[model samples]
Target: MADPKGFMTTPRQEWPRRPVEERVRDWHEVYVPGALLPIVSKQADRCMDCGIPFCHHACPLGNLIPEWNDLVSREDWRAASDRLHATNNFPEFTGRLCPAPCEAGCVLAINQPAVTIKNVECAIADRAWEEGFTSPRPPERLSGRTVAVIGSGPTGLAAAQQLTRAGHTVAVYERDDRLGGLMRYGIPAFKMEKHHLERRLEQMRAEGTKFRPSTAVGQDIGAAELRSRYDAVVVATGATAWRELPVPGRELAGVHQAMEYLPQANRVCEGDLEVSPLSAAGKHVVIVGGGDTGADCLGTAVREGAASVTQLDIYAQPGTERDEDAEPWPTYPKLYRLSAAHEEARDLGTAPAADADARLFAASTLRFGGDAEGRVRRLHLVEVDAGRRPVPGSERTLPADLVLLALGFSGPDRSDGLVDQLGLELEPRGTLARDAGFATNVPGVFAAGDAARGQSLIVWAIAEGRAVAAAVDRYLTGRSRLPAPISPYDRPMTV
Candidate 1:
């Protein structure tokens, strides 16, 4: 253990966020710069480094949580980074974007706040870059084999990096003009800056990984042609076919999907455009889903100077504390949590909703009322019970000039005809069908990440990528040595 009594004595202290007023003005990340390193070591010391270490079991990547926590506590930055990289291909991305289910599995969380594992991880990753600890590890000799990855998201990137280091010529194809997939456009800059992604792409290029942006496999190049060129093919295309809300006035001019709205805002930040055509300025915005994407929309709208913002949740509000009978310890619970976006909305009075956090739990959208020009002008809703049945005498309407449906995605988009060209089978849940070994029915073709699994966290995507790379490497060579973090059938703990 780093410290014998550290868990008992040290209280968890997370990285501090910048003042709402200062951060909302620009697109920089919310955390205060250079503030984590000073306090992270102490926070890391709180790890009990338990014999069983449920945190490790909880993480999809099987990250060496206790080991790295001890290393960070000892101030051995190099060793910590090395240990962190052993299982995870990109700690920087996960440290920022992952929900950190591992923390929920922390032993300390049974009684007290969990150790600041996420903050410690971010600090170590940032320090690794600053101290010149990270570098490209190109293969010493080529295997004379080539592989093609179909997406440029985290899953595709991780698989490509692994295959390249194993001496295979790997090429990643992305339909977007730039790489990084959702991290490039779906995610906003206020959550994570683009420079972090750019530097990592630079490192991947240094390692001899080839990238083909703006090249859609089924559209630009035939899938059969791609299969003939490469020895093996891995599909890591993410689930981006967004779900739509089928309600009255759905075709109104001001109603949009969250994906459509977010990407345009991100383009403006990328300097592709001076202003987003769908800017939320001077509009009363209503978001229909209450997941992380909805919170993202809330934050983006707040920054864009929306006149008012409100989020609707189909489920009732959860309790502040975990319910032991329903969700025991070491399992992620559905507790009421205040995200940074909700905090900004609450403080700025931008939501105008009765709820302090700008969210209406148990709220269901009935329909939208539009103006003569067919622009959405108001939203009609009703409160619901546990069974989702409407409660009596609880109907209301709110002004809404702009309505964003933040409902999540269903499965991988097939507009480019990738699935049809390859004749890939899909599961009942709308994901690409794959065997336990991450192999598709077609020989020499594999599927992983959200394409095989459903929409999931970034940590799970990286794990799936690593696992699929191992499967692909084994297929190419009679015998191989590559770490597979999780089995294709392995799933996360859910309540």
Candidate 2:
């Protein structure tokens, strides 16, 4: 252990964000750069290095958390990076995007605040990139087999990198003009700058992972032709079928899916447009949903200079601390947490006047009202009870020029005809069905990530990608040395 009594003395410290007033003016990441360097070690030292390390059980990747925590406490960043990369293919992405269930599972959290595991992980990854510890590791010899991975999200990228290092010729097929899928356009720059995604793509390309952008597997290129050219196929196309809000004013011009609104802002950020077509600027925005996507919308809307922003959730506000009775230690608990976006929005006072935090929990949407031009002008909502029934005489109306549905996705998008063209059977949940080996019903075809597992965290996507690569490697060579992070049926520790 780095320090036997470290956990007893040090308090949990996390990476600090840039001040709200400053961050709201630009699209840069929320964190104050270089702020974590001094405190990260103390935070890492808080890891008790539990004998069993419940953090491992909580993480889908099964990362060696304690070992890396010890390394960080010792200020051995180089070794920490090495230890981190041993399991995770993209710690940089996970460090920023993941909710860090590992921290929730920390044995220290049973009593005191948990170690700042996510912050430490991010520090190690950033250090590795700066110190040149990360380099292209191309295979010394080719296995003579070829693989075609559909999609360019975290899962596809991870699988492609693993298969490439295993000596197979791999090509990633993406429908978008650029690589990285959601990492490219779905995520905003303020959360994670696009440069980070670009730099990693460069490394993957240098390592012999061929990328084919602007090619839709079932549309631009037929699935039959794709399968014929590749020895094995891995579909990592993420779940893009967004959930809908079907109520009055559904056909209104300003009522949009979160996917529709966020991507437009991202495109403007990418220089595709001077301003988003659905820019939230000078408008009152109401976001429906309280998950990460809704928070992302909240942040994006604020940055766009919206007049006001309000987020509505069906569930009541979560507790600040984990309730051991409802959710005991070791299981990832659902607790009230303030994200970087929420902090900024709160500071701006764009939240509803009465509900200053901008969140209206236990709320129900009755319908919507539109102006003469059919543009969304207001939202009709009511307070809800524990049973989700409307409370009596608690109805209210809010002026809203824009209504964004940040409701989560349903399953992988099939509009492009990839599943139909490939004749792949989908589970009842609308995701592609796969066997324990990550193989689909068709021979020489497999699936992974959100495509197979439904919508999930980026960490899970990368983990499943790594696991599916091993299954594919063995299928081709009859045996493989690649690591399988988790079995197909192994869900995350979260309920």
Worst ten-residue run, lDDT, model 1?
349-358
Q: What is candidate 1's lDDT per residue for 1-495, written digit by digit as tens?
A: 879799999888889999999988998999999999999988999999888989998898999999999999999999999999999888999999998899999999999999888888888888999998888889999999999999999999999999999999999999999999999999999988998899889889999999999999999999888988999999999999999999998999999999999999999999999888999999999999999999999999999999999999999999999899899888888899988899999999887764758899999999999999889999999999999999999999999999999999999999999988998999998999999889998789999999889999999999999989999999999756888999989988866
**Candidate 1 ranges beyond 4 A from true positions:** none
Write one digit per residue (lDDT tens) for candidate 2, span 129-176: 999999889999999999999999999999999999999999999999
Q: Give the number of colliding residue pairs in candidate 2.
A: 0
